[model samples]
Every structure is written in structure tokens, then in C-alpha cells.
Target: MKEKVGKQSLKFENAPYIIGAASVAGPKEIDGPMARYFDRVSEDPTFGKDSWEEGESEMVRQAVMLAIQKAGVNKDDIRYVFAGDLLGQLIASTFGIKDMEIPVFGLYGACSTCGEALSLAAMTVAAGYADNVVAEASSHYGSAEKQFRFPLEYGNQRPLSATWTVTGSGAFVVSDRESEVCIKGITTGRIVDYGVKDSLNMGACMAPAAADVIYQNLQDFDIEPTYYDRIITGDLGKVGKKILTDLLKMNQVDISDNHMDCGIEIFDNEEQDTHSGGSGCGCSATVLAGYILKKVSSGEWKRVLFVPTGALLSTVSFNEGQTIPGVAHAVVIEHHEMSKGK
Candidate 1:
């Protein structure tokens, strides 16, 4: 039987299989460095929808449909759809997946929605609560900009510390049945607030939370930094990356050799004007679906620690001058070939 691994972690004896994953991104993302791996790219910013919010919904729906099709499972076969977005009340997830006719559990973890959704979906399958589930997340540049900052028409100067919001969606189908990619374990994060009030620099606000989770996972499992081929974080841009590395160094665990951030990997610094990098639910979700999983499937990476970080702030709270808190969740994915060798 599957059992709890350690503090804040769960061991999946069945190791819920990642049957398939799909990424759908906007035109700018489609032209980014990791563009080739995405399943679908929308050339239109609105994606033929009347509004940016509606466009985000389309991306989620398409991603879900594509992932299900790739998994070779009927929509009816999925027991539940676990999804979320940066938008208020998960509007994107609710309206986007409504047509699928599958039961859903809407989640909100800021940019870490992907990781949270994946962890819960894996746990549900591992615990025999479900046979298959779809975990998905999305974000849109225009909608997030208008909601969080000034509208696009304002053309407010984005400081170097500000990261661009990604316009994309990613969906993953996790099942109890065997597959090429499977989830081995998970480390759920805690809310950490360092009293940072600057809404522009999300990386700085979320780095501490990411570091804490990484350190906790390591200590709980009695593992070294070199245990995995890569220790990947969601969207903690360049600034957060340094903070996380410095924090880990204090803990006597160095991950610089293998640490990679999805935000840093997604865009070319010089070519793209994405200041620090990308941030949003889609930033890490799309990267995980389009890049990391593909790398693992090819046997290039044996095991990986995929952590997605999120800044817990809203327009109301930020406007009221509340500090931005952050959280992160970890998922350990291993390839079938690697599992066989073990």
C-alpha cells in the first residue's frame, strides 16, 4: 500500500502515470525558444475570441481536449478535471472546461496552480479515489495585465524587475495505469510571507517560499542535491533564482549545477523584452508539458524535481498595501525506462 513518505510529502506506490500532456500558447510564446514542443500555437492574440479572457478559456479547452485525445481515453473515462488560473474565481477553468461535461475541482495557487493540480490529481489516483484525471492551468498576458496592473492602453513602463505574464495553457492526464512518465512523489508547500509589498517584483516575493519547499523536501527524504538530474522551479525569474540559490547554500545544499527555472528557459533574454522573464500560471505549466516531460521521455533526464511557485496577491489586497505571500508545490516525475532500471 502507498504510504506517507515524510513531513509534507507523499509516496505514491502506484506512481500515477502521466499518460499525456498538451500545451497551447499565444503567438509570442509560439515564437519563443521552446515553441517547437507545444501542441498548438495561436497566431491571433485573441485566438478568434471576442475578448482576451475568452481567448484564455479557448486555450484551456483545447489543451484539455488534446491531452485526452493523446492519452487515448474518452472524456467520460476521466473521473475529474482539476484545473485553475490566475483569473478571479478561476473563470478560465470554469467556462473553458464546462463543455467537456466532466466533473471538475477548481483550484487556485497563483502561478503554482499547475503543481497543486498535478499533486492532487496524482494523490487522488494513487489513493484509489479515481482511475484517471486531468490537471490543467492557464494564463493570458492581456487579461492578467489589465487585472493586476494598468491596462494595455496605458502602456505603463514595466520595470526590469517586472516579469511578463505568459499567454498559454497546459493540460496533463494522470492515470493509475502505466505510462511512459509517472509521478513518484510530492512535497506540498506552505505559505511564506517576507513582508514584500512590491507587486512588480514577484520573483523576489516567491523565492523564499520556493527555497523553503526545496529545503524541506531534501531534509525529509534524506537526499542530497545531486539526487535528481534537474531541480526545476516554475517562474522565479533571474532575481528569484539567485535568492533561492543563496538560501539553499545557507542550508548546505547546492543546486546550481542542475537548477533550472521555466521562466529563464522559455525566452531568449536579449531577443525578448520580457524583463526578468515570464510569470503566470501558464509560464511553468506550458513548459512542463512541452519541455521537461519530453526530455524525460527521451531518457535524457532520469528524474526531476518540478516545483511551481506562486505569489498570493490580489488587486484588492495589493491595493490595500498587504504584503505578497508565496507558496510552491513539488512533483517528482520519472520515466518508465528509469523506473525499470531501479
Candidate 2:
């Protein structure tokens, strides 16, 4: 049986393994620092589709199929799929997996959808509900901008704190099978609002929630920040990175030495002009599938706390003058070699 740790965490009795993972990114992302790490990069922003939304769905399909292929498993063998995107009603994820005929649970956590999907997939497998499952998340710059902000044709100027939404998708196959990387535990976050109203500066809105979860994870596990080789956040750009570190320091839990932000890793801010950095569901998802997993599989990183953060505010909420509450979900990933150390 899984042990329910303090407040909002779970310690798995039979940790689930990430047997395979895949990342599919767009041209903009291909030009970024972690470009070579992606499984596939499409030169076409439309992904051969007529619309940006359709292109995003195609990216999701490519990622999910490739991950299954890498796992050497038949599509029929996949019991369920947990996926979502930064689109209304999860249309992107729906169209992407509709033809596969697998049972699916559409989720939404803004940029944190990847962590949320992965956590639920791990829990399902750990609880013996299925032999194998797929977890995926996606985001596209064009579609996100059209829905969340202004139209592409508008060409509105962005503030320095604004982050570029990543155009990419990442998928993973989780199973009880032995593998190099496994999920040991999870610490789910609660909605935290600091009365921040600026949607452009998402880092400020999400910093409090990220801090809350990190603090709780440390307390629940009875460990310090140094317990893991690294603590990675999803899309908290340059601004969020500073706020996150400072908030942790206030709690006497310092993680500055080993903290990494996917947003910061994906792009060269100065060169790319991606002011703060990258945001959206794909930012952390793609980095984890492409870069972080490689480090863990090769034993360069023994353990990691993967926390994807999100600023929860829709265009409707923003226009309606509602505060942007933030949420983050943390997953504890470990190398198979760590089993021997234990």
C-alpha cells in the first residue's frame, strides 16, 4: 500500500517507472539551447495543418506515438492516456488521441499539466490499476497567444517580464517494468494567490504556490534541500526563479545551489529575446523528456524533485479582474542505481 505522507504527498510502495519518453518541438524551440535533445523538431509551425490548433494536436499525436514506439509497446497495450493542453476544453489533447480509441482523462493545470498527468499516471500504475499508461502535455505559441492574449496579427509589444509560450509537446510511458528512471513519490500543491493581477508577469503570480509546495515536500519527507541532486521547476522564467529562491530562503530551506528552471534552460534569453524565458505546458515537459531524463538515465543526476508551476488565470478571468492564483505539482524521480544505495 502507498503511504500517505504529511499534508499533501504520497510515498509509493511500488514506484512506477518511466519506460519511455518523447519530445516534439517547433522551429523556434529548435533554435534554443536544448534543441539537439528533442526527439523530433518540425520546421513548420503549422505542422502541415491548416490551423495552429490543429498543428498543436498533430504535435501531441507525434509525441504520444513516438513514446509508445520507444517503449516497444503496442498502442492496444496502453490501457489509458492522461493528457492536456493550454487550450479551451482540452480540444488539442482530445483531437490528438481521439483516433487511438484508448480511454483518456483530460486534465488542466495550465503549465503544470505535465506534472499532474505524470503524477496520476504513476499513481494508477502504482496502485495496480493498469499495466501501462501514457501521460502527455502540449502547448503552442500561436494558439496560446490567440486564446490567452492578443492575435498574432496585432503584433503587440510585450513587457520585459513576459514569457514566450513554447511550441512543443512531450509524452511518457509509465509502467511497472524495470527502467532507469522511476517516480518515488509526489507532493501536490494547493492554489495560492498573492493578489497579483498582472497576467504578463506570471512568475510573480506563481512564485508563492511553487514555494508552498517545495516547502511542504521537504517537510513531509523529513529531508533537506540537498536530499536531491536537483529541484527543477516547470516554467518559472528568470523572474520566477529569483522569487522562488528567495521564498525558499525565507523558510530556512535553501535550494539555490541545485535548483534549475526549465524555462531558463530552454532558451538563451538575451539571444532569443524571450524576455523572461519560456512558459506553457511544453516548456518543462519537453525539457524533462529531452534533457532531464538523459541526465537521470546516465546517472549524472541521482535524484530530482520535478515541480512544474502554473499561473491559473484564463483570459476571461483576467478580463474580469480576478486574481491569478498559482499551483505547482512535484514528482520525485530517481535513478535505478539509487535502489542499490538504499
Candidate 3:
């Protein structure tokens, strides 16, 4: 039987390394002169869909194909595909992978699905149940706004904590090969709730979860903060990132210089007009697929930890006054021996 991480046990299987990864983004830049927030909508015609329903699945499909190609793996070699998105019922992921000719397992992790998918995919490959696995996440602004907040035509004022939805998709291919990036270790988070009532400020709601998992990952691995070249968090914006730093200090762990957050790093906060930071699956996905993967391939940084955090509340659940539940998963990526030699 495959070894599983028990609820309270820190024991875990070392993640099989990530061999390949890729990301894609919508053409319309929402931050430019044509920006209208909600009124303008996405005017980019490349989406090729009249509405959210058609475009989301297309983005997911494109991301998966790119990842598979980059990984140098054929579709027939992928044992299983694990994917998710912010859309209701994971419409983007389900429809996107339907024709990939590989068995698929659908997941729902709100905005944190990217890390969640990677964690599970690494586990599957590491445990030897499969030789190759594909994990991916995608999101679009139109569908997310319509489903989570309001209709496009509603034109409601957003709260200061409301995060700008990102338009992009990211995918990764994990395999047993020792030539590319290796998955080091993963730390899974428990549901945490501190009675924070505002869903708009998801950073506040999810920061604790990110901190908890980061602490546990270090504890579980018996590694020091300095051991990693960088420690990255998925989508905690400015406020949440601060909260996470403070929380880590409480545990005697300092990740100051080498730490970065995807939501904060993806776009320039001042230039992009992002009030706090970026959010959604695309936030981390794009960063990993675009920036981090290239760095790994180039041998700029050898070892890094990626923790994607998620707020597990939905529109209906939030409307019913349920407190937000949060979770995070950590994946370590490093250059392999063969790659480093080259």
C-alpha cells in the first residue's frame, strides 16, 4: 500500500520531481488604458468565446497541452490527470481534460487548486502508483466575478480587500525521471478558521493556513529556513503576507529575504493598480509556469518551496454566514543532478 500522511502524523513520501511545466494567460491586459474594472469587461478577442462558459475550458485545454509538450511526455504516458479551477463544478478542468485520453480526477480547491493539484500529483507519482502525472489549474475573470461576487452588469462597488481576478492557466508534469525538477516534500494543511468574516479579504482568512503548513513542513522535514533558496506562498496579498511573516516568527522561523508570494510578485502593485495583490489559481500558476520553471531549468536556483493557500468558502456558504475554512499544500522543486551537471 502507498504510504499516506496521517491526519496528525508528519510522515510523508518524498514527492517525485516535476519534470516539466507551462502556463498561459489571456491576451487582454486588464490593467492598461482600456481598463474599466467591471464596466469594460475583457475586450480581448483572442478568447474566441462570447461569454465565460466557452473561454474557461479553452484556457484549461491549452495549458494542459503546453505542459505535456514541455515535459517531453506523450499523452499516452500520463497515467492520470489531476486538475481543478475556481469555476463551479470545475467546468473548466472537467471539460478541458475530457479529450486528453487519460484518466482524470477532478478537484475543487477554490483559488488554491494549483498547489493542491501539484501536491496530489506528486504524491501519486512518488508512491509509485503511476509513472507520470499531470496537474493543472485555470481561471478567468468574467466567470469568477459572475459566480463569486456579482453579475457583470450589477456594477457593485468592490470592497478594499477584494482581489483582482487573474486571467491565466498553469500546468505541470511530474514523472519518475531524475533529469528535471524534483519534488522535495509536501505539507498538507488542516482546516483553520479564526472567525474572520470578510470573504473579500481572503488573505486574512487564508494566512493562518499558509503559516501553519509552512511551519509543519519545516518541522516534518527537520530542515532549517536557510536550507531553502526561496520560500514562496501562493496568493496571500500584502496583508496576509505580513500576517504570515509574523506567524512564522512566532515559531522561531524567519523567512525574510528569500521569501516571496505569488500574488505580490506576479504584477507590480503600483503599476498594475492592484490594491493589495493578485489572487486566483492563475496567480501562482502563472508565476510557476513562467518565472520559477525557467529559473529551475536555467539552474539559477536549485531548491525552493512553493506553498499555495486556499480559502475553502463558497458563495452559498459565505451567504449562510459560515466562517471561511482554509488549507495549503507545499511542493519543493529543485534541479536534478543531471541537469545541474549540464
Q: Which model scores highest in lDDT?
A: 2
lDDT of 3 by residue, 169-242 (tens): 88888888765577766677777887887888889888899888888777767789777888989889888888
Tell me the deviation in Å of residue 297 in model 2.
0.8
| Global local distance difference test of model 3 | 0.77
Compose the digit string of candidate 1's lDDT tens values, residues 207-320: 999998999888877799799899999999998899999989988889999999999888875688998888899999999999999988887898999999999999999989
Candidate ordering by TM-score (highest first):
2, 1, 3
Quote the positional error of residue 162 for candidate 1 in Å: 0.8
Q: Clashing residue pairs, candidate 3?
A: 17-182, 17-183
TM-score-best of 1 and 2: 2
| Model 3: CA > 4 A from native | 1-15, 28-46, 339-342
lDDT of 2 by residue, 220-286 (tens): 9999999999999999999999999999998898999999999988998999999999999999999
Candidate with better lDDT, 1 vs 2: 2
Best by TM-score: 2
